[model samples]
Target: MVERDRLIAALEDATHASSIHNSQPWRFRLVEGGVAVHLDPTVTPRTVDPVGRWALASIGAVVANLELALTSRTGRAVVTEITLGDSIPEAADLAGGAAYGEGPLAVITLGEAAETTTAMTAARLHGAIKERHTTRGPLLGGPPTEEEWAELQAAVAWAPGIQATPASEPLVRSLLSLTARAEDARQEDEDYLEEIQNWVENEAPSGTGIPRGAIGAPDAEGHVPIRDFTQTPMGSSGDGEAVFFEDPPALLVLHAASDTPVDQLRAGYAMQRAMLEATALGLGIGVLGQALEEPDSRAAVDGAAEESFGAPVVVHQILRLGHPAGTITYAATPRRPVTDLILD
Candidate 1:
């Protein structure tokens, strides 16, 4: 029972470590030797993530963090075989150095917990895993403190292929402008608009998808920049319109060279890791994948980011990183019960 409680706590820590549309999409079950993590395919935001790639990617982030937290505790994580029975299993007897299998679906075997895993270490990071949330509000004036930024950069060091950098002033302007342009362009596509609207409106208060209060009405004055899923009538007034900040102090972009599911998963993991590192440093990070998700917008954003960063932009997600104007509150995103997601 104690072991079950430990695994449950670890599962919550890892899932909370992931980033979605503030939509947490992971569930876990305590098995004989370990826990199995399954995706709530039914709850996925198909409108925003048509292929379930982002959802899987989010799960991958949870997997990575879970593995890290588990291993960091015991120095080794162990189990039996990875059973890909509908849902992905988190524990298995697989080696740490092995790569994921090539397929739309795969499972991983976690080794035994190493002796290095201590109560203190796990407790310290435990708080970080549970408390982290993405901040989408605006930046104020300057960049984050040198120390904080350095710490963030260091946290993602495990993710070798992904690159993270703070957006410069000119870079920020160009990215925001590009994002806005992308939104305008998306308005031209009725299907895309409908899809996005469905995701925005259908979300339960704590379930998947972006919430109405988090997104402001497009025509409202000083609207905090967010994806306009509503495609509302041009002049319609709604709660979607609210100004949180005039200009954000910093923006962070995560990019990789490869576009494989594995790489996307890696990027998601790195993004979450960096976000938690930022939270630990008293900084807020918000994801803005609107432009990155659209084809034309993707090209523009990629080209501009590539030019600025001096690297080809395989941009997976865009994040706003800065301090919030005041204490921000967030609701707990819902998760399916483990019994529902895991197969026997």
Candidate 2:
């Protein structure tokens, strides 16, 4: 039987994984063999993620953390089983065997921990869980070395049905432009604005949502625009004075073979692996989901993906990678305590 303390510790590590706006829309339950991850619809951003794509991805990230944590703790291989409910039920069920209500996003089973090269690699990535934070501040330093880039690519390649493509300079510019347009459109929508405002908190008692202090100062005009989580003016006014990127940082487009709930979950797993690998290599990473979250904008990116990869694929997320600019620090986003997240 899995030690109760170790299982709880792994669950805590799972909470540290990334989520949209730090919403952390997930719950966990201790099952017979391992843990079951469920989507907490109460915290899901319905306006932005009506289809639960981001929610599934978020759960996938949690699974990635759990696997790494359990493997490291017991020195065993972790196996994951995914179940898709009918029509992708909105809330977790949490009755009897179906811990997630309708159907679970994933049920991860732990194997006996063993001493192996793979386990050692997972241990290293597991160590990066706390160190890995989604960077919104300006990323500084040189681009990743070719070898480092290859490693990141390999990390994604390890997962089936997911592909990563490095964006060219022109494509990157197009993506930025598309993202800016999407952000502008979202800002104009009253419901979208209201929903976003509801999720951004200067100081959240629940320890979810984007913190004001974590908001980056606005960039000067002509630089890539980041989503303004603060709603209020937070970053530097683009006076066209400060220089941002000497060389464009690495931009990667993550795509799934098909656009299904299971595909999205797998994509999320691959994404977290890539991010953790990047963190282990001393690289900073940020995600731009504005375009992907918008229907028209997402279609544009899908077209781009088709052209870039010579096959039609669903673009799930965009990752910005580079070294950080000088010494950078920000308050960590708050997460719900394990007591609140555990169902049993």
Candidate 3:
């Protein structure tokens, strides 16, 4: 009964984690020992997220919330049983990575020791979960200081499978150009435009989709590489009004050790932690995910990040970070109730 209560509370907090389009593609089942995280096969967005990269990452974010919430709520260490092993599993083990997408990515169970280290970290971050709002608009202020940057970078060290590389101005330009190309292509596709807009709710009280309040206008100067939800289905930009987005946009790329389903989840795990940390630091966060969703742009991201970091890596996620132009507290995004998200 005690375990059931902990799982219930943690699951509630975990549902607040990020997902593409607020798709809420994950489901949970109460197993004998712990709660099981499952990816609902039908929920993957065929047009926008054709490759399911964000789906895997979305599951990973949920895993992160569960880990933090379990430790934060109970103030104790928890054991997470995942498919990952001592190291990156072989290709045969990954089996093109799709093999595991339909099953539980992880099982969260109670553990013995009260490790103060993770407990403290969890307490700090878990509190920020509710405070996090994916800022889609322009961030006004400048970048982080060396100290702040280091602290923000440290959040990803929760696991060894992922590394965070801050983008230089030149690198940022190149990456954004690639991202803009993809965004342009998406804009041209009426089907994709319709699909994305469906997720963008112009009204609030959104139960499980991107609310209208959450959607911001494209950069007036077309400088930032943000996805233009403001685009209409008839192939036009929104409102004839735009704002100047911060240029050389503060960017951070998350690199995973390999391109596997497990690695994608690992990158997301770290991404969520860093996002929570950024929120704690009073930073606004945006995603340059369009760059990662296209093939050519994806390769450029991988090559540029590898050159920047001097290592072989898979580019999984990119974040644009800075102080918000407006309120840091935007409206809450849509999310299904925890009770509704659980599997029978």
Candidate 4:
């Protein structure tokens, strides 16, 4: 069994994993195997994540952090289980043991390490946990090198059922179009606008929402379709003048074998692993979640993924990577304390 203090420490770091709208919709409890992660539906956004896709991804990020931390500490870990239910009869039949319910999404079992051989990569990624912030600011210093992109691909390789591919110029253009269309559609919905307004904390960081400083300045050229979070009045532009985002935006799409609950969580884990790898390489990262939020655009994103990867895979998330334009500092987004997140 894992030590109590170690588990607590790991949980503390795991909270830093990215969540949609900064809504940390995850809960953890100590189990016989290791730790059982549950979905906290109370904080899940009803407007954006209608079916808990992104919510499960958020939990997947948490699982990534936990695995990295525990493996680094003990040099051994087996992610035993993750249950994101599939209610669709055929899908449920295909995804064995994926029962839909209030059960835990994943259980990470740990073991002692006699020597530190397998944990080298784990330790490296674990070190990047605190450094992984959602960077919406324009990333410069030119596009990441091929070596850097290769490092990210290696990270994705560890995640079974998930694949990451750099988008082509045409595909990037298509995805950007989908994002812009989705953003425009989102802004029109009163419920969606209200969700943005409610989650954006203008003055200071709260226990849950994002601060004004963290939301990056808009893209001056209007090339990147960054989500505008400063919409208290509904459709209000982000604060500060816009700047030019990196040209030929380096976009990576995380895809899965099928659009099932199991695949969604696995892709989420891969998403965090890739983020941590990018962070380790000193790369700024941003998510184009809007592209996969709307139904039509999401299907289009799926099609684009199949075209890029040369396989049948569903689009789970799109990430933007680049070097920061300058010394960019983001206001810290708050994470629920381990005490608050841990179940009794």
> Judged by lDDT, which candidate is best?
4
Residue 334 lDDT (model 1): 48
| Candidate 2 stretches greater than 4 Å from native | 85-101, 202-205, 232-247
Please say which candidate is ahead in lDDT: 1 or 3: 3
Models sorted by lDDT, best on top? 4, 3, 2, 1
Best of the two (3, 4) by lDDT: 4
Candidate 1 residue 342 Cα shift, in angstroms, is: 2.7
Model 3, 223: alpha-carbon shift in Å?
1.1
Cα RMSD to the true fold for all candidates: 6.6, 4.1, 3.5, 3.6
Residues 153-207, candidate 4, lDDT per residue (tens digit)?
A: 8898777878888888888988898898898888778887787787874322247
* C-alpha lDDT values of all predictions: 0.59, 0.76, 0.77, 0.79
Model 1 bad stretches (over 4 Å): 17-19, 22-40, 68-123, 139-142, 200-207, 211-213, 216-224, 229-237, 244-248
In model 3, the runs with Cα more than 4 Å from the true position are 1-3, 84-101, 201-206
Flag clash pairs in model 4: 85-100
Measured by TM-score, how close is model 2 to the native structure?
Answer: 0.89
Q: In angstroms, how far off is 251's CA in candidate 1? A: 1.3
lDDT value for model 2: 0.76
Ranking the candidates on TM-score from highest down gives: 4, 3, 2, 1
